[model samples]
Target: MKNKILVIEDDRAISELLCMNLTIAGYETVAAYDGIEAQRLLLWNEDADLAVVDIMLPGRDGFALMEDFRAKNLPVIYLTAKDDVASKVKGLKLGAEDYMVKPFEMLELLVRIEKILERTGRAKRILTIKNIQADLQSHQILKDGIPVNLKPLEYDLFILLLQNKNIALGREELLKRVWGEEYLGESRTVDVHIGQLRKKLELYDEIKTIPKLGYRLED
Candidate 1:
């Protein structure tokens, strides 16, 4: 099956061009004009293997969209005109597997896209957290035989925390690792997700917030 790619660019010219190039490169392409539309498509389309996003857009913008993708463990490449050093650094820091400046060679984009898809396709097996078990492959969370259905981001955040259990993960780290660096939203996003996970896991007091530092899962 051809890998599906979502392209979020408000400019019709750019969007259509990307779609054409992607299709010719043997990838199934879906185009959305803005962040809101892109998000709508993502919720409805479960087959998207990768996302190529532009930094500027109406409504949510690329950074915000990338945050949503990160929570779902989706691999992304930023295709944007925001080519400053800071922008590239931010995108990479936020877990974007790759960043391609706008007006880039189509061949380069194709290569980068393939590389990212290959990397993300690698196995993500079960992750054990204290007494809880998270099977990332099946998106299942279990505690002593009981099942827990976590919101997508909650699941990702829980796994990240569990993987680094007992170690302090600063707010910036969580934001960059889980939310993506281009995410300009409040840092409290991490706290909110953590709170939700703690409540759902019924592991009260398991996640500790260090004053002026960050969060950690107690061993």
Candidate 2:
């Protein structure tokens, strides 16, 4: 199936150009002129594999829109005029898979889209731990036949732990792998996120903390 992409940009010219280029690149594209419209489309469209969002939008703005997308477990790329270091860091912190500054080359955009799709596609499809089943493709987690709700980062952390399974993962390794290398937060951030995941997954006893090392999921 062709990858479906949602492009949320307020500028008509830029949106049109992106839609045209993405269509040429063999993607099914949906365009939204503002954050409100973007949110509407996202809520209604079930096949959106990825989203390219501009920071400055008419209504809720990109950051707000991104939060919604994150909740839906949607991979996102930020396309915006803001090229400052602060903006980049903020977007990355918000869980964007990629960031592209404005006036970007169409070819470069294509490459970025391809890379994001490739990485997301290569992620684990299913994760089973104890009575829990995580379906990466559908972004659903079931615990003993009951659905479990996880925040975006929590889901990523859970999948990572399951992928490693019995192997002990260090704080730095988990931070880099799940939060991206550019993440400048303290290592303790991992602990907080892991705690949240444990609580959400009802696996507090299943996740073993290795004191000075990191964590391991018990088999």
Candidate 3:
């Protein structure tokens, strides 16, 4: 099952954008435009895994809405325009899993959300994309319900690509993530592995090569 996330923001554009991206990232999202609406949703819903809240809301700010989220046992990440140290400290003290000042990168937010979900033991073990399914716990990849043999490094690289699907990752970043910082490998190594992955997984169309950047695994 996809992990369910709640987005509590007054800005309609931002809220819609977040929900769209979250959906593309294989998560189920529920959006509430105000704290009052969020509280109403929480009262009716009992299975929200996490929440992304904006500080300034029409009826009750994010800080004020924490009690409702707490009552639901939902972890929260504050995504607000408020950048003051006081606000940050208060949000942390209020038990937010993370805080991000607005103009935040969507990729960073997605990564942070994934990390918090994993840390809180709310992450889904199996990740599905089309006919492929990856067992995160067992580190196994299956295509069409059959096990697909993958080398150790290939598996790690695949997981990285899968987790950050549709996001372009540079060769240096891929090298650092998959091969480690001390590996001292050339960028060509990434290309080789990517080629192997594309051939092995038969993902020629899905795994895109970004010009001047590196690669992006399209969902």
Number of backbone-clashing residue pairs for each candidate, in the order shown: 1, 0, 0
TM-score of 1: 0.55
Off by over 4 Å in 1: 122-219
lDDT by residue for model 2 over 114-166, one digit each (tens)?
66876878333666778999886788999998999888888888877875555
RMSD of each: 15.5, 13.6, 1.6
Q: What's the best-to-worst order under lDDT?
A: 3, 2, 1
| Best candidate (score: lDDT) | 3
Q: What overall lDDT, based on C-alpha atoms, would model 2 receive against the true structure?
A: 0.83
lDDT of 2 at 188: 96
**Which 10-residue span in candidate 3 carries the lowest summed lDDT?**
39-48
lDDT tens readout by residue for model 3, 1-219: 989999999999999999998988778999999888988989866888999999999888999998888878899999999999999999999989999999999988998999999999999999877789999998889999899999999998988888777788899988988899898867899999999999989999999999999999998
Error of 1 at 206 (Å): 61
Task: Report, for every candidate in turn, its global Cα lDDT versus the true structure.
Answer: 0.80, 0.83, 0.91
In terms of TM-score, which candidate is stronger, 1 or 2?
Answer: 2
